[model samples]
Target: MKKSTLLIAALMTFGTVKADEGMWTLYNLPQAVYRQMQSEGFLLPYRDLYESKDAIKNAVVNFSGYCSGVVVSPDGLVFTNHHCGFEAIRSHSTVEHDYMLNGFFAKTLADELPNKDMFVSFMREQKDVTPQLESLGYSRCGKDQQAAMVDSLQRALTDSVRQIDPTLHVDIDPFYEGNRHYATVYQDFTDLRLVFTVPKSMGKFGGETDNWMWPRQTCDFSVFRIYADPKTNGPAAYSKDNVPYHPQHWARPSLEGYQVGSFAMTMGYPGSTSRYISSYGIVERRDAENTPRAQVRGVKQEVMRRYMRASEAVRIKYDSKFAQSANYWKNSIGMNKCIDSIGIIQQKRDYEARLRQWQDSTGFLKGQLSFPLLEKLYARRQERVRTMMYWRETFRRTNEFSTRAMQLATGMEVKGPKKNAAKKYHSFADNSNEWDAALDREVLSVLLKNYREHVDARYLPKFYTTIDTRFEGDYTRFVDYLYTRSLLMKKGAKLYYNTKAYKADPGVRFGQDVMDVFYDLNEGMGAINDSIETQERYLCAAKLRMEADLPHYSDANFTMRLSYGQVKEFELGGKPSGYYTTPESIVEKMNRAAHITDYEAEPIMKELLSARDFGRYTDKTTGQMHLCFLTNNDITGGNSGSPMFNGKGELIGLAFDGNWDSLSSDINFDARLARCIGVDIRFVLFMMDKWGHAHRLLREMGL
Candidate 1:
């Protein structure tokens, strides 16, 4: 067959263009893709999307480091997911003023709570840096060497940029499996304040039961304001003198709700996707990574759940921790199920086979990409990777004491001044306010036992010997002894600059033992990992050459991307799932809250939602308030707070989640099943007006 015919055959086998797929970067988006987007219903001009000074992309901000958000008012009032702001909410909550439970609304600027170390970043520009790297022989170097070069270059560029403007941040990221690179410059504002939030019962209404499921009504959004230097409206640290930032552009909120086929677009920083990974890599991820994560987190969460249910204090302390753990635990379980149900691994294998045939026929990268070598490398590293995941899940931050103790132990190895060491020790030691002793002790004991049962005897930490021999294999007894004898567990403990005393502490010894095992496991995998990385890069390059005609988008790397689709629905259990949900669904769920704890809500929530008048928030066509809607926009983790815009570039909603059927989308874009779930913008306004009485914020958004 001819090369074009062979490519077509490969495309047919891979099903590359199914539905509205791709998380495309706006800077270098193909004209073909742009035309397709316009055909689908995108009405914004190409220049207005990114190139113009008042572009829509200017309004989008990276929420802290893990999520996305959009500026909605000229005063820099931003909208993001409630769960994305979870840590900030948890930090400000005290027994006297539990913001997590009662909710918080700033009636004025002074009332907005300032958060420490919280910031939002705006991407100023992104330009291709591939030519510069290529001039330095980046393409000819090994993966490890290229990484080092990139690091050096990035630091140099950042330093130069800072010399010109101290507040700008720079990130040089590799794209297309390291075949290309882009430097993104950002201006980070460090004085973000909490503007508004709903109570836990409303913000997290559906909880885990409806976490990744469809037909949902979770109002998963929160509000904040970014403060800037009053002199120049540039980035600034938190201070009373700082004022709300005046952005060049802000998304206009629209009360006009969308229909089943209304155009939808989401622009945000998606965290990760491995769409170009090999079949062997997929198998390893499924068995080694996801399996251990799901299994171990399940055990840990159960312990936390029991303690949390018994004490409100414990619940407040562990709420954020549990949410983070449970979010990914459920995701891993769902991803594994989808991998099997959709035959993702076999599908990858089929695609690989076709690619190899095309390469052999055309002599395009025929000898460079070796599937057998990739397979062998993965096989060699699988067991060690599995053991490492188990080790990580068992010890890494499973409890507060061990985590702090490990930091202290690691600090002991630094050849620094005694004063510097003392400062580091005290910093690690002053975490008493973060965790409860009883709850952490219980968690450590359970995970200790769990770790030993799963890992090999040789892989056990040296502390396991202390437990096995001295404490007679009683994990609880051993844990109790460490807690009692270690000064690290004491609230007012001090180091006193005594290295001998620190080394002799039981908690420090336990920490050292854990680190030793981790170091050993990591060292053993270094060469195997190098080989696998090389093979994967070759595989990616080969695929690019074989299908050069296709509009290939790179895997997500927490960079800003735009995904366009429509407000569409999908089949669930062989039935047509509706495109949107209404307040009635939320009321129905609250009615069943007695049996299903996830559905529980505050009494006031029911009263407000049950009210007859939704005012202007009501959808004219349906004559009811729409809660959440579904779209087919490709998204992943960091897109949590992404703004969903209608064809006219008006903010319609904030994307918070993906449906359960699309859990495998990270590896395989099952366009038919993948759906982005977003909370309606009107619902956000309704809650603000009715529950929070936040008319100031509503008026600021021009609602």
Candidate 2:
């Protein structure tokens, strides 16, 4: 057989259900994959996973476009990860309530709290619309031309679709580098209400230290319900008269839990991945992109830790911010470690070598220069990429509060559209006030000095030089000068302030100067990226041509996808990595005060674990309560809260985190090491029944 044929077979089988590594889509489950599912113990009808009227498809939802959830009962009771709904939980909490500490369990429907601006969207339908998008035949067009064409066509299509139903949101997403397209019509339901949640001590056990790590014991699940307008049975803003929605399908939670070798399928939205990215892209990401991000976040997190430890109020205010930074900070560190350890760059090089060999033999491949152009473009833009990374890490990430100031100043600076401009400025300021000036100033001080020292002078925004000449490189004093009198820092000051007030302010002027430089630098970056994207699309077009018979699944883009795998064990360093974590294993690590940010194994919970209290929901074979389990389901960030179903399509677990070893999955999947960590559904039932004593909620689930 030819080497290309062998490569095609390997590609199909490598990151798949057989190897527990493919993030397969719901649009079409391949024939080979379907046969593999049946062989592995899947008992449901093949079409059930994708058919519009099926239980599975109707039950699952896209949670506010950020995470996934499943309806557990006909009354619209939804279940998702605690972190996915963390913002709502935090909003409802205060020093008086402290729901984050003790948790909430609505004993009755009346007790359920309505949340503002929270929503869940269900997929109405998805269809291939490639021909419609490609009819223009502008594959070779420049960025401007492509954008104009796409925008015009999209507007026309969306307008026509909206005429049928004004509420439906129909998005046409491109796949295979614009070679294919799919349109998914969505039904968005607002007026979601909080039903129940475990305490932070339990839901977020082990804290950031245990995030993305296995051998886990975190029951990261939250419950909510969708409320629909009584008359229309459609989404509406929160109202007292609203009634609970009864969805078409809901998942049946099983106490007949899974074990090692049990077939599992994960269905949810997964965020972005760059599996088809070039080796040049890989090198740039590993060294230039991720390196600075990790270092900068590490520093910022240290500053946040100090403030959080000093005051509980501060901790509550910055909890989400810290978690967002820490997530990728650790991932970047892990990616750096594993990319070298696992030789990912070398793997890409080897793959490229084969591509080159194949190209040499084919006239069409030999004639195209896009493949090598990708490498040269990335290399040439390395310095600009480095500076932008630093700017993003320092100014954009750490000094986010400063952006609010900038936004307010810019909004005030607008000359025309007086009434709307006033409303816009006020709204932006109102929303952007979710930051602590004290903490932001500290971050700004530390980051500015770090930024000046680390970033190259030539690539840096011109504001740095101004700060140097004016403040003599004392970044702290410069920050003090900016924050002390700047209207942006003056809380409760109405947005009606004069534009000249903003123009005269030092901080506002500084922000404007920085933005001006940023815009100039970005123009340069925009050109490079435009070229890269064009070349990348061409390369994608070429590869599909080259590997004509190969099976291809589009990269994840926070859209609904289905990944099939199994409950299996792994090993690291000659030690067996077990499938399920028992209660006894978690109790031994109980230390209330060892780590300030870490969750303590409380006495009540520690006792339960140590006593081995196997409730009715316990695994029958082991007679031990399973806290969490592991599966290789090719999931990413947005998969948090996705239902992990048994082969019988019964809810077995709630997918939450991916294993640390699989951090490189976005660019290159690791079949042997990649694993998805899930909270066992049995344990969730046990906790909901015994710990939370929310039997009323259980009864609604038909328990």
Candidate 3:
């Protein structure tokens, strides 16, 4: 009779459990989930998966804090997505020796290229800390205060650990939408070096055109090795004396390929997901966040594409930047489309109605978790949020001059000896070679004009007044004037830091004006944002209580998680989409490269792929070299380089992407449509042996 009663009745009549769903934490995987995994063909014992020192979890590493990777050899050889190592590749590339264009392979350990600020972290352990935090009044603290408390706790834990081992690090992150908390211990190895990579033509094969799409042929892999202190065999900084790290455990690379319905699993750090978000939050993400991001980045990327095509130097400098921007730009577009097509907002609303009914019937968190309040708050902030997204995409790191000026402007605010020290360290020459002045000037003018036209007049930076008054409302003229007068535009310029002169400089003034707008927007939305966060947390708590009978996994926060599924395929356009792609697909795409440049590859690629004598890399069943495959494993952004393993825990491939039709998986996981895209391990080995002739490294892996 009552809504809550109806909710219960519906649950009984139609079960809500879905298979092949969840980014499950390994330390405390639910017994029920494990049973389901067993049904799906998981072969290892529970302890073998997580508890033992030789567990596969020990081999997974947080790749430079952005992606996932795995140790695959006794020599600490690591494998990750080509795009994961993109910046390192770009940093080493030059016109004469372009590693990105021609690829790189270290013939000897001494030839391995060292990267600055590159480190891989091995997660040692994770445990719940909610009870401890709750005892210290963490549950009673307001949303604004919890962050500081967590930070203090984390620092104390980290400092205590460093006393014993300086290489160890600690992170305390909230889970289940802050209803639970866990502390993770990690050991970091800082000295990482590039070992092998395929050229961009092969590594980034199919490029943006095939990214997030099915039937992918991209190899999408790169190799690196970790170095440790020779004496202690512990983490160390780069030194000639450092030796190759002999890890306690590593994944065995399997040439034995997978078949449709074969057991598949992925273990790695997934960046973030909003599966617990309310319907109002979905609306906000769609209209306020994804919409503006897609629109602004599309305009910016076109400008970058034009310049990059015109010059090889510009292309090399901006390749990494362009790829980063383009990856998410298309993601936003696909996410929005999937959100609408899947009717995710409507589904969430229906679930929220049931949750509200349950709360009302039980009088549990009835007043605290108010859906109406969430709707009102989101409605009030939608315009400001959209404007903020536009502002961030338009100016934030899009223009080199503006980014440097902002740094100098912030540096000017410090007082005392620190102020002078900051001035001494400040130099425009830092990374000055990464950007072209002509490209930057053009980008500045285009984004400035676009920002003014799209956002409200009140949101415009103060420099717009200078343009109107002095340059007769011409963005190009104003940008040219600033470039001509500002020392910040000079490649090797030094800052004098005189208050009057610094304030009067057009570059600093522009940066300060932009920052002023940013500060104002943030300040105005501070209370509103906090209110929204509080509501969302309570909503999550209420949902957990209502669905207490169901097994739940926490939302991903760039921590290690394992997702299990099968090598499976889905239907597209009323036809079955195959689970794997072959070299034939690669050749077909290349043949059409004249119309679709994304398919263009090195001339050698065609010959190598077309070869009939493919040796052991060829699949025995299909008698073809598989380029990529599909699995139903749950994954997200930071799972880019995650290892996809067969039932025996042998590495079969590296997870690189998700199908475009399931782009809304971040907010809503659709078991029917969602699938993970992985580059086959054999494809990686084929490239290493056939293309690069990397026999020494292959022998090290015992292949």
List RMSD in Å for every model shown.
Answer: 2.6, 2.9, 2.8
> Model 2, poorest ten-residue lDDT window?
424-433
Top-lDDT candidate index? 3
Q: What is the alpha-carbon lDDT of model 2 when measured against the actual structure? A: 0.79
TM-score of each: 0.95, 0.93, 0.96
Summarize candidate 3's per-residue lDDT along 466-566 as a digit string, tens digits.
89999899988998999999878776666566656666788888888988888878876878888888888898888888777567788999999999999
Give per-residue CA lDDT, model 1, range 254-321, as digits (tens). Answer: 99898898999999999999999999999998999999999999999999999989988888888999
**CA shift of 244, model 3, Å:** 0.4
Q: How does model 3 score by TM-score?
A: 0.96
Candidate 2 TM-score, C-alpha based: 0.93
What are the clashing pairs of model 2? none
lDDT of 2 by residue, 1-703 (tens): 9987887676566435245656666767776677677877889887788885765878999998789999999889999998887878877887678677778988888899988778999887788876765678656566678668777776776787779876677777777776677788888998899999988888888788888788898989999999988887777788899999988889999889887888999999888888877788888998889999998999899999899778777777777788789988988888888888899989988987777777677755455545667788998888778777887787764675567555654554343356764443332335432566678889988988787778777656666776779888788878888877665656555434445654577666666766665676677677788788766666676677776665567788877888878887777667888889988767755653364446585577776667645767778878888999998788888999999999889899899998887788888888788889999998788778878899888888999
Candidates in order have lDDT scores of 0.89, 0.79, 0.90
Off by over 4 Å in 1: 1-16, 142-144, 159-164, 412-427, 495-500
**Candidate 2, superposed: residue stretches over 4 Å from native:** 1-19, 159-164, 409-433, 462-466, 494-499, 592-597
